[model samples]
Target chain A: MFNFEITALGNMFFGLTVLVFVSLFFVPNKHRSVTLYSLLFASLACIFYASDLITLFIGWEIMGWSSYFLIAKTADKQTLQKYIVFNIGGAFTLLGAIILIYGACGSFVYSELDFSAVPSGQVTAITILLLLTLFVKSGIMPFHYWVVDSYSQSNDLFSAVLSAIISKTGVFAFILIFFQIITVQYLQTPILEVVAWLGVLTSIIATFKAINEDEAKRLLAYSSIAQVGYIVTILSIMGSLSLEAALYHTVIHTFVKLLLFINVAAIIYVSKQHRFSTLGGLLYKYPLNFILLVVGIISLAGMPPLGGFSSKFLIYTALLEEHKGLLLAAVLFSSASAFLYCYKLVYGIYLGQPTNPKTEAYPRIPLRFYVPQILGAVILITLGTIPGVIVPMFNGILGSVGFEPVLYRGVFVLGSDFASFNGGVVIGAFGLIFVLILLFFVRLKNRSVKPKDRLDISYCGEVPRADVNLHYGYGMGRELSRIGLIKMILSRSSHALWQRVSTLFGDLSGITQKLYTLSAQNMGLVIFAFFTILLYMGVK
Target chain B: MQKGFVAYNNEQKSLEAETEGIKNSQTLIQKAMNWFSARSMFVVAYGTGCGAIEMPPVFTSRYDIERLGVVGVATPRQADIMIVSGYCSLKTLRRVIRTYEQMSEPKYVIALGSCTINGGMYWDSYNTIKKLEEYIGVDMYVAGCMPRPEALIEGFVKLQESIRNNTIQPGYVKYREDYAYYQANQEKLLGKETQPVYEEDYAGMNLS
Candidate 1:
């Protein structure tokens, strides 16, 4: 039987997917088949619009397979294997959870589930399985081994879809299941707290990884992981404010990634360079593209007079409401460090002197590329100027999901009981100051001269030869390793963390022995008494 | 050979003599601009020899040249003044020329110590250039074997007075008009082009 229903959360996600798909028309897909691409999109729709567990699973699997095929075209054997193994493993866990739910409830339909009949222990097991699946899909750490390889190795445009659209499906699934179907009251608070910490930790680690990466796409891939980590962290709070913040971030991140990826794609289109060391000083060469990238980065960093700040403001307020001071501190620390990578992304690509001489003659970007960038840029600016415009939509989602609507009022000004700011005033002030400075400089009698040659920079009176490693994109995050705590975070991979979990199981019996010894004097008697009791039990 | 800047300076001075100090032949706006430029000087002092040792005492809290509005900047492009601090060797002369060319117009140069004036210690050495003037224009010279920080301060004060009063020829104007002469001298000594040189009056000098 086919049962289809629509919800406010699904509609928002589906809308974003459509916006992403609209940009793809500009990109010429030369792949072996339009069939695979269509399948991917159709499956995405299925997942977003699915009414029951079965329908969702069917869509999820199709999306997975189709994307694997798409990525297989560009990615190497090892990357493909990594992609399939992790995704298949996640898919199996999802299937296992669905089967268990069906067995327990005797139905797969959304409205038909009766958790009252299910055993509490079985429900906890179900929760673990479901969380594991979501964690893998969203690239939460200790379960995020496959994300970076696939996103960076995939074709440029598809990687945008992977980050901006697909990764968010995991988030959609989370709300669809936890907020609507299962609800959070059944869940233990300790589980959610651990999830929140996992998310923030993921972001902090992924940020450092992003900065350490040299290849452009790989760095963006790491950045994508870090951003999704923030959403997951905030979502775990399960408050209306947290949900609004997560949704706002989701919307902003979609447009920001679309803008950045398309901008990078356009750069790669002309320059044929992928590494930051090879791509520098494109600011003048592609002025419009550079400005768009700057806009994207400004939003990415959550600065004021940009849409990013609005969501970040909401996220912090939500955390503060919960009195999650330690978690908020960690989240803030990660976000502050994020500025370094954001700067690296911009400076590595656009600002510095071009490492290659041929970069000067790189071809003009196609008009099609600007279509998505302009669309993204306009939306971002509008959101920054009038962030309150989308609140009613968010309020509608919250209402449909059975929660209280937040107190954000009006289009130009965002006001709540806790915090408020006028977007128009922030933008107006910024514009006025910029104009004043520009006018002052332009009216000066003594004009500032730029030397005709790019190599005219003073280098302690010595001229730099053409081959010097001027752009240190590879070395951007290397300094962080010198710090003690960061060094520990940077050295361990997700695989290492998982490996430790297995080792923990092997040490369980050994842990029992240590558990019995409370003090140094008791330790000697405890060990002797334990051995005697074991020997007496063995004889009996 | 004072045709370019010094002659220009005299024309303005005579015009000022008639206006007599109150108006001083300059518009109020022009006078204001001159006053601002003289008050804030960013210096790029290239330390090629012994005089380099004396700059720290001048710059640090002990002497604090910042009160006089003469601050040291790292790059030539940001600097309004360049001090050829001591003896200019053949190798050092090339960089100094390159840096001088990079600085914008309204720039001045101070050739420090007797070494730059007449090559005090390195005078008889093969690599040293004796007179700083032939290679590039010298706006003011603080004369000593290793000029005292006080002497250097005096040189800056004198330069600032000339800048504020609009009386003396700034070196950049002279370099622009007589670039060919400087380039020819540089090419004869260094045996290479130090920087990009556009077409100008040759000031044809026989290098040999």
Candidate 2:
């Protein structure tokens, strides 16, 4: 029998991920009822619940293969290849670290491992390997090449699952291994500092990449990476507040992505279009979906009156408290730049003039699509209105993990030792102002004049013909590439680095193949020569 | 025939007299509402021709139209006024009509330049419509080959006064009353496929 222990951190993530996975039941995917997806969910549960390295690794492998097959159902060969390659690479790195830990500790149980008793050098080596695995899964830059392709190419609903839940497994593993087992105090400070910088840098670069992407899901994929980057950065701080901030962000990101990806998936289902350039003027046709997307983006942009703001506020406060001025500045820059992409996501699909003439003829979105979006929106709104409701949960998790509980009390108010705010007041003030403005607008005697034709837009005195391209979606973010810093960032490609590595591997494989292909007598001579040299050196 | 014509003229005159009397009897609340609408005019900046060149300067640092509570809005749903700032080619006329109709009630159209009034130099051109009022309502016209920013500002001020005093029938009111006429003209030029049938009006009719 395998030992299984449940912690607050793992239980919360597992519950939320499974909840989202289950809520996706309404989405009528071809693979919706498939056993593989359930198996994937089950394996993730196992990983979350595992008390020992052996059981964790077994669950991790199951998760990798199950998701691979699930993605293989829809994705092309190349995408599948990329997914398998990167994920297997991560799994191997994880296995290496686990084996090393077992070798050193003489036990596979997480609680049995004591890194303080191990040599400092071996501890550093194990930590690096574990970090590598986490970095690959979480998609920190340079190692993030496969993320965009895998995310963009996966099944629409599965893409949401992949982003919202699966990626956070890496964060879960990080907490379990680093904070719980190894303990942060024993980790090298210099290496952790580098990890912090890597996190912020990844967000900055990923934000620019997201802005330039034309495909809606790909843009979202990059946005997901950037968001996770923030989580990684805050986690690197290794403080109680920072841990709370990380957990808060984890919950916020999951809901925001679930809502947004499902919203985009709905649009894609209706219009049969995935590119922003082809999808526009959808708001009137899908008002409910559009509103849900707006809620999602508002939260995603970390604006006030939404749950995104609370987590963002905590993260900034944590950074400020630590006096990480430079890191804080970079994070602020990334957050500010996020507004552009958030606007693009909405405007690309909903706000602008219709691009395709046949867009109006598209079928109505099914009610099933709204299920996940509404769930996400409700959770976001509730969290926004009463952030303190979740704080106690986080505090319990922190206590289990040997961190201080956040100094917050009351149902709607969230506070730290340094600063705090009442979420209810924020929501109340915003609602009052919104209602007042809406009432004033309604009370005005002005009547609405409906346009007879979609083409009835002002184009001077001249009329825009049917052939005219009125959609501004594609053009909205094009100018961002002209900015100095953004231009440099956009001009570079991580693909080149990956390509060079592949070519080097290809050449090395070729050289080894040639050696193996040599005649048996030549191979025997080479082997004897090698042994003789080894034996002579040993005698010397 | 002559007696009938004379009777019709008399009836028209009496109707005008009644409307004039009603206009003069406006209450203080109505006056204040007009003032409020006038003070905060959201303009849908539709640049149709050469006159559009002058608008950017007016709205920017040089002229600063913001001082007058005039703001530029992106969509017609939020706008109170549509500025038709140049020649009305047939293609542009279609869009202008659409943009005009999209605006909410109490909306105003400020037609700028000689091109909008009489097609300017494009009068003989095959594509440009010579008169803009035939297709849609025109509340005010600022005349120039290309109106200067100051002249455009003056036109806005005059339009504001007319709105505040209820001195003239607004264009949107005329549009609602004579929609059939406008639709006929629009269809004649742009073809019947140019616009969709109004859902509200067609709901009761069993066209199928």
Candidate 3:
């Protein structure tokens, strides 16, 4: 029998993200995609509404298989193998935790679970197993080997959905299982503290990886990992304000990724180029797309007058309120370094000299591509201008999850007991300054002279050969690799450990295969002798 | 001596007549624009040859060009003046032409060294052009094997004065009015495929 629960937490996430699922219909994908998307949508619904562990497990399996098949449609053999292996491993861990919970409680329903009656050892085991599943699904550090490949190799539009909506399921599960079911009082260990540091570390490493990336989508994939890392870090704090901040960030990250990924997709569609070296000076051709991307990056960099800044401000304040100074410092470092990659994203595709002569001859972007971008941009702006609009909704979700409500002063103002600010004032001030500057520029008597050709660049007195590359997009972050810590990080790969483990398992299985090489009669005799000894011991 | 003096006097009288015509036609707004343009010169230093070695001294501490409100910019879009230092070979001329066209309106060109004036020691060479003005307009020429930093600075002062008094038409205006003449000359030297037809009207050519 199917068991479902209507809760505010589930409604809040599902309500916002269902649009992302619907947007797939508007995008023109070549693969036979409708079935897989529908399967994904249905399974997500099942997981979101499930009131019992059994239903949740079933939905999780369906989501895994459908997404695997969808990715397999276009992904290479290696990427597909990584995706399947990691996801299947995560599923096995989830199954183990559910079995442990069922054995302990003698019930599968959420209402019947009693952590207090369970042994502390069993509780820790269950929590660890569940944490493993969540970590794998969310692509946390040391377990994020499969993420970059799967994200970059998938169909471009689906990649956006994977980063934005699907990744949040891990956050959703953490809130549900850890906060609502096990409760913080039962944790008894500092596992969450370890998780917080790991989250920050993942962000730091991933930011550098993002900076070093040459491929556009791969860079975005790394950025997605970094953003999710922050959410995981905030969730680890286990306070009401931190919980609110996590949810706020989840919503903002979703919209920001949607806008950015779709924007890049449009560029890729038009230019038929993915490497930064091949694309440049597209701003004049697609002014609207460029503006939308600028908006996306501004929000992503956590600058003022955007929704991203509001959530980021909340995250910082939450850390400050908890007196987590070093952790806050780490988070701040990652945020500051993120600007380089953000600028690279814009400059690689939009600004500077055009590298390929054919770039100017590329056809216009399809109208359908703009639909999702425009939608995401509109929502982001609304959230930026009036961030307080989502506070009441978040507070409702918090209440359903058994957390105290956050303080609310007005419709436009957001704050905790520590600090508060009005979104309207920030937006107003930014707009006023922007308008004044624009007016001053317009009134200036110095007219801008248009270049006669793309080759018309100041190259000293020497004329540049036609074959020379003027684009510095790829070279911008190449020097970061020379820094000591960044060099160490870039030199090492997490995949090496996973490869070693697999090799060890292969060797063990080979030893086991040697026993099967014996004749059938010899194998039967060996089993008979083993059973006789076991029976003798039992009788004694 | 009497005949040569008479001819020189006639040339001087005609030059004065031209200056009077320009002064009478100048508007107040044009005068103000000239003043502002002369005051703030953003130079795009396109180092074409060996003379580029001397430019570092002019911009850096030895010359301190910034004290006169002349700053170096990286891109052509923001530049008001381009300094083509040294001799330009056929290969370099392609880029120089592109850079010159890329610059914004009211742009001036300052060609330095004897090479740009007439190819310097590279005169009669197969690859280098003797006259730089045929390919693009040149406003002022600092004549030397390699112009000294002080001489370069002096050339800039003279160019600024010409801009301020509305006494001379900037080269970019001529490039706009008679682009075909320059284009034909550039094509004759650089082959037809050297530059792509840009998507804008230049003089009479509908490139789009």
Q: Identify the leading candidate in terms of TM-score.
A: 1
Once model 2 is optimally superposed onto the true structure by TM-score, how far is the C-alpha of residue A364 displaced, in angstroms? Answer: 3.8
Given candidate 3, what's the lDDT at residue A19? Answer: 78
By summed lDDT, the worst window of 10 consecutive residues in model 2 chain B runs over B1-10
Looking at candidate 2 chain A, the ten consecutive residues that score lowest on lDDT are A455-464
* Candidate 2: tens digits of C-alpha lDDT, residues A397-461: 99999988875867888769789989999989989999999999999755444656776655543
Compose the digit string of candidate 2's lDDT tens values, residues B1-208: 1221111111334545645765678888877888998899999988988889989988899999988889999887679998888997777777788777667667899888888877889989999988787787787777887678988887777778767776666766665667788788888898986563353452243320
Cα lDDT listed for each candidate: 0.83, 0.85, 0.84
The regions of model 1 sitting more than 4 angstroms off are A495-540, B1-23, B197-208
DockQ (CA atoms), all models: 0.32, 0.20, 0.26
Model 1 / residue A436 / CA error / Å: 1.9
Better of 1 and 2 by lDDT: 2
Candidate 2 wrong stretches, greater than 4 Å: A520-540, B1-20, B32-208
TM-scores for all candidates: the values are 0.88, 0.84, 0.86
Q: What is model 3's DockQ versus the real complex?
A: 0.26
Superior by TM-score: candidate 1 or candidate 2:
1
RMSD of each: 8.4, 6.1, 4.6
